[model samples]
Every structure is written in C-alpha cells, then in structure tokens.
Target: MSINPNQYKLSDRTARLTAQDLLPTTVSAGTETREFLQKVIDILLDYVKAVNDRNEKVLDFHHPEDMKRLLDLEVPDRGVTLQQLIEDCAVTLKYQVKTGHPHFFNQLSCGLDLISMAGEWLTATANTNMFTYEIAPVFILMENVVLTKMREIIGWNGGDSILAPGGSISNLYAFLAARHKMFPNFKEKGSSSLPSQLVMFTSDQSHYSVKSCASVCGLGTDNCVMVPSDDRGKMITKELERLIMERKKMGHIPFFVSATSGTTVLGAFDNLNEIADICQRHNCWMHVDAAWGGGLLLSRKYRYLRMAGVERADSVTWNPHKLMGALLQCSTIHFKEDGLLLSCNQMSAEYLFMTDKQYDIQYDTGDKVIQCGRHNDIFKLWLQWRSKGTEGFEQQQDRLMELAQYQVRRIKEQSDKFHLILEPECVNVSFWYIPKRLRGIPHDRQKEMELGKICPIIKGRMMQKGSLMVGYQPDDRRPNFFRSIISSAAVTEKDVDFMLDEIHRLGDDL
Candidate 1:
C-alpha cells in the first residue's frame, strides 16, 4: 500500500480543489484577474489619448435624463464578469467632459501633467490614510519639504504649512488660525468668550470662501465685511481703513483681513502692501487668498504684479492645482508663525498621535489639521515640482501671461465683434461677444441688458456644438461676459485663436 509521491499529491490536491478556490483575492486567483486589469489599462490609455487629442470634442452634451438612459447604471445583486465591468467604465468615460482638454476653460483647474498623474496613481495604490507618520511617513516628509520650499518662495524665514483639500478649505484654515492666534482660548470657550462680535474683512471681489469660512467659524456672515473695491476691482485701502474704524466703534472685534491676490471674476490683485499696513494698524491678522495667482510667485517677471508684501501677511492660501499643473485639490495654507496650526486645530486622539511612539513625533502633522483622514495631495505637487524644476515653473508662468496678452490683443483687434471688459491683470481674459443685432448699439443700458441675455444663448449653442468651453458670470455693474482662463499649460496660441474664432462662429448668428 506504499503510494508514489506524484500520484499521492495529485490525488490529495484534486480532492481539495473547488470552484471558489480559483476565484480572486480574499477569495482566490482567477485567470480573468490579469485580463481585467489589462482592460482597465486599455481604457485609461484611450482616455488619455482623447484628452490629448485637440480634434476630440471637449464634452458630449446630454441632459441628466438622457445620460441616465445612455448609461445603463444599475446595481446588480451579483457581480458581473470583467468584460461587463470594462464596458461600464467605457460608458462612464463616454459622457465625461475631458477637463484636461486644451480648449476646456470652464473651470480654474483645467490641465493634467503626466508626472502628477503618475503620482496620483501611485498614491491611489498606496491607499494609505494621512492620519499619522506611521501610515504616511514618506508622504509626511514630502509634504514638509514642499511646504518649506513654498515658504522660502514666499520669502518667509520660518513658518508652518498644511496641504488642505482645496483653496476653500485653506481659506477656512486661515480663518481658524487667525481666530485662534488672536484668542487662544476661543476654541475651548467658543465665540461667546469674546466680549465683542468677531468680524473679518475682505474685498467685495474676493472669493465667496471668506464669507463661507466666517460662517463656518461661528462668525455670522454679517460679521464678514464686504469692503469696497476700486473701479479696477482692487480693494480700496481707504475704505478698508474706514471699515475697521467703524467696526471698532460698533464694538465688533476686527481680527482678520483677507486680501485677494487674484479675484474670481476680474482676476484682480488687491494692494497687498497697503492692505498689510492697514492690518497692522488695526492689529488684524492678514491672509492672502492667492488661490488663482500664487503661481506667479515662480515668475520673477510677474511675482511683483500681485505678491508684493505677501511675506508680511500672517498667512497665505495657495492652490497649485489651479494655475500650476498639479492635479486637483492640491491647496496649501501657510502661516508666518510656527505652531499656529497645532494650537488652532490639534486634538490628540488616543488611538492616533500617541505619545509613546519611538520616533520623533514632531513629524506627525495630522494633529495640526481639522481633517483626520486627508488625501495624499502633496505627492502630486512634490512630483510636479521635481519634474518641472523651479525654472520650468517660471517659464510656465511667463507663457501663460504671454498667452493672456495675446488673447487681449486679439480681442482689441476685433473691437466691433467683441467688447473687452478691461485689460486682464493675470490670465483671465473677459469679454462679451457682440451678436449681429447688438453690434454698434452705442453700449446703452438697454443694449447691455440685451447683451447679457446673449451670453447664455451663445453658451448653450457652444455646448451643443461641443467645440469649446469657457465660463461666464456677471459682476455688480457688468453684464454676463465670457471669461477665458489661460490656466492650462496645454493651451497654445492656436488654441487661443481657435477659442476666439469659435466664439465668433457660434455667436455671430445669436
């Protein structure tokens, strides 16, 4: 009854083998696993190809109901095969607008860099929470190094920095830090600890995030003062001073002043030097919202255009995802003083940020942020900075400015066809395309009203055509105007020319 080694193994193994044993993962390995991954890679490659293809339409326009019908989106009781999953991905991409397209200018974030894309994929694979040095040690160090370099660029001798989810969260962090710096006990005691109502000031042209932050910080929206801006959209220094004095007289504690480095609609930069001086005179913390214009800091030629006296500010909110080619949601809020964020937002959860760790715990930054589980936003930015280098970034800044100038020049050349809002201070070129009926109407109030309606009409037509995309909005006195943002490094002079030509082509008959 002696069994041979090969025959014995085959008989035993065959009895144990089952269909479930061949399935993938916590289940088992299947032949289709690798094939499914390859299919995913193929779909991803096709997406990248479409994004880089200038001939490809930026968006495939469809209503929500239509999209629902086009995509057979339904949850199944059982899992489908790899082939069905691959088809689902393809269908999802079919309707998604290619934000990376060169002609897509509908949002502040509009470009993709291969280096950053690689970083994002790696970060996803890492799939680690940014809650402690134990989980994301490499990412924590990368974040520190990147933030230190950014602080140095801002001319800070020493400071602290944190990568927030977006510019809005960064702005919110600035508010929280400023509030805590002024009143350390406010966090524990709440806003009621203050004898006077807490108030903050920002230009009417500043992003709406300031008011949103104010409300989030227990300061009512009414406490966020909308300081008047000059005709060119820069904050009025005299008005700011007046408002501070008025708030003091009304017994409101004016503790924060936010200066805009680049306004949302107008792309205007507030007078940072004058604003800093006013903040000092009023004993208010200064925070600059450079979400859109901070990339100019890399450009020696244009840094002075907006970031002058930024080093004097108490804090800055900068978003690399906007103008610089970093992927979306890479925003950082920096403080001119060390330990401000820790004092403001730290809550030592016993489960995390333990005091008994063997390593130097100073490297752990999760305690310094309001979020416990943050995304690894720093890696993409760090990888981008490494690939592009400082000089590459400076060149990128210069090129965007040049392209914006080109857009303005072209708009001026066709004055009868397009009305320039004003000369752009940054890469935002805003103008209204004059339809055939509205041409040479002497720009009266009624004509302005009529032109306002034409914007949406033309925008809808452009959407239907699926040729180009640009943003449109109305300022206080101005009507809705097309704001073509040259934030994408992928865009060229040809694309700029194409944008103008497309606008004319779509709008001429409107």
Candidate 2:
C-alpha cells in the first residue's frame, strides 16, 4: 500500500516529533488549545474581577492547603481543568496582596503597567535564552539597541552592555568589571593574585548591594568603606576623597567607587560629578547604581546633572523595574568597552557550544553572561519602551516626580500630626507617625530609643487597617523613618492624600 504523494506520509519525522514531545506538553493556539487558553483566561479574568469586587474580604483566598498540595507534586500528572487552576490561584491570591492596587504602599515595588505585564506574558510563552545571536537573535539585538540607547542617554561614546537578572546582579557586575579593569589578571588568577588590601567605596546612603558586592568579590564586606553623607544624604565629596587617600596611603588598592543616583532609605543622589572627579583622580572605576533614579533619565525635569558623569564611569547598574515600572529582573550592567564583560566571564564551553571562531558559531550567548540560561527579560522592557517611546516615558517620569512633590506638600501641610522628613531624590518620602497616645512618650532620643523596640505596635495596626501601605525602619545614618516609595504609575494625588489621612486616622484612635 503506497501513500499518495500529497497525503503526507510519515517518513522518519520521529526526531522532530520526539523533540516536541519531550517539552512540557503545553497547549498551542490550535482550535482545541485556543479554547482551553480562552477558558483559562476567562477564569482568571473572573477571579480577578471577584477579588477586585470584594477586595477587603480577600483574606479567604489565602488558604495554604492548595500550596501544600502543589508542593507535593512528584511524578507527572494529567492536567486539571482550567477552573481548578484558577481556583488554586485564587487561594494564593488571598495572601497575594495586590501590589498593583492603589492601596499597596508597603513595598518599593508597586502597581503593574498593563502593557508591560502583557509583554511579560509573551516573554514567558516564548522563553528564549539571551546568550547569543543564533537562537535569541531578536532579543540579543534588542538588548544591544536598548542598552546603546541608554548609553547615549548616559553620555557614553558607544558603550557595551549586558542584561543582568536584577539591579543587585547589575551592581555585582559593575564591581567585577571595575575589578577586571584594575586587575584583569584577577579573573584568570583569582583574588589571591591581587593585592590583599584592595578596597572599594560607596556612600552611607547607597544600597546594600555595594557591601554585598565586596563580599562576593572577595574584598571582604569590611573592605568596602562607607563614606559619610551630608545632611541631605548626598555624598560628602571631601570625606570620599579623604577616604580614598587614606586607603592609598595604607598601601591598599582603591579600585572602585560607587555613587548612588537614588539611595534606598531617602532616595539620595550622591554628588556624581564630584564623586566621578575623585574616582578619576584616584584612577578608580566609577560606577553609578541608578537602579532607582535611572528612571529619572526619562525625565528632562529630573535627570539633573546627577547622571552627568555616568558615561565616564567604568560601568553602570540600571534597573528599569524600580522606577521605569518594567517587570522584575530587568536590569542592565553596561561597560565602556565592548569585550570587557566577555573577558570577565568567558569560559570554554567549547566542549559544547563554541567553534574555532574562523566562522561565526552564532548561537552562543554564554560567554559574556554569568548565567547559562538567562530567561528572556528583554521583551517586556523592550515592549514597554516601544509602547511608551522615550516621550511617553519622560511624561511618566515627570508626572511621578510632580506627584511626589505634591505628596510631600500634603504631608508637610500636616506638620502637627505627621512629621515628613527628607527631600526626595527619587520620590521616596520619609515620615513618622506620633499618635496622641504615644506623644507623651517624649519625642526625644532618650525616650524614642526605647520606643524603637515596639515598632511592631503601629505597623500591626497599619496592617490591620489595610487602607494603605508604607515601609518603616531605623538606620544609624538617620533616625527611625517610615519610607514611602512612589513607584506606581497608578498613584494619584487622591491616593497620597488618602495615605496621609489613613496614617493620621490610624494613629488618632490607636
């Protein structure tokens, strides 16, 4: 029995079919698959609608049995109805706590950008890796384009860049790149070959990532000197220079300097121009961790001169997720030289993925990255940038700054009940809640120092109210301050106004 030529006989197509079968059998957008997907989507939409409708009652969705069962998965199991998945998710949503909702102020993270969220869905579905030009051709090129655009904005004369998993890793890469620039031999010979006294510097106001970088790079966390900052949280440029000189005089290698465009506690911007000059003089690598304030790059209203010296730096860490509102894990570690990253991270995966280099063995992105299979995080960022364009982003940036200023004003207007402290560097407002009951405890440090132990008291009340969320903590650099991060594009004047009212109202009866 011969099959007709057009009848599509099964020749040994088993290889292709077998490969397809090996992958998790996800439904494609075929007739049946599309219906299943639609069902899933519809179920999710309804579930979201339900939560939105009865938001305050969402605690019921927090059942952990569903979680316990999901964790119990051992062998392959048949797929359940989309309804079952939706129900399980709804259970999770009970504790989900809507970050996108206007009320979610508890985190530096905030509401979703709809377009970016949809882009993330597309990225997940595609799930391409970001190593080289072969399999991830589109994403790799987009990475180059987006990073180059940022470089031009950062005032670079054609810098090289790579996408890191997060701002933290981006900071780590900056440290490594600076180390590579200073001691290129260190990569090949390890830290043992370098001066034992190598040290780096950051501001008292900078992110903890700098300290983490020191520990990770074998410089010892104690080796990372925290320079003092001015009252406004800007780096004390004089102190910084003195610290560098001190380290150098001790026969220690001062190889890197990190300036913050936006600090964690107060959103402080270190004097980048001044710090850059110091780094230039000391022959140290200058890295700007603009993970928070880099979003200000989109704004003519705020990019300010803080970013002025970024391009002069050996590297930068910019996370679009923080202020630009892209999905999480969308950060870039860019270098002034083209091959520095690859030089720092290259290994011979030659046994698996490389060629003699006489011809383009294109499908490899493994060399320049620390990760072997980095998920495609570029699409969401690229998609958001595309949809918003530079202008759209600038508008968003300007508006957020303006709203922040507005929030500050409203908070200050209540000088009696709430004490708003600190000028914003990237839209974080710091304050303290002094209820009438606690006011007698004396606002003096002698009494406040003891009260610091009972911080859980008011935080618990705030949590129960659920009217809004704000962050709290105490640091030695500054007294106990509640940090209010304005990261959501959805935040309006009403939301901030309500937040102030809630803080005061909660404190009043407490």
User: Candidate 2 regions off by >4 Å?
Assistant: 1-32, 46-83, 351-353, 356-364, 438-443, 446-455, 477-479
Against the reference, the lDDT scores of all candidates come to 0.86, 0.73
RMSD of each: 7.6, 8.1
Clashing pairs in 1: 23-28, 24-28
lDDT of 2 by residue, 275-313 (tens): 878988889988988888888877876776446656667
Which lDDT value does model 1 have at 374?
93
User: lDDT winner among the candidates?
Assistant: 1
Which candidate number has the best TM-score? Answer: 1
Please write out the lDDT profile of model 1 over residues 328-424, one tens digit for every residue.
8799999999999998989999889899999989898889999888999988889989999999999998999999999999999998999888889
- For model 2 the TM-score comes to 0.86
Q: Which ten residues in a row have the lowest lDDT in candidate 1?
A: 1-10
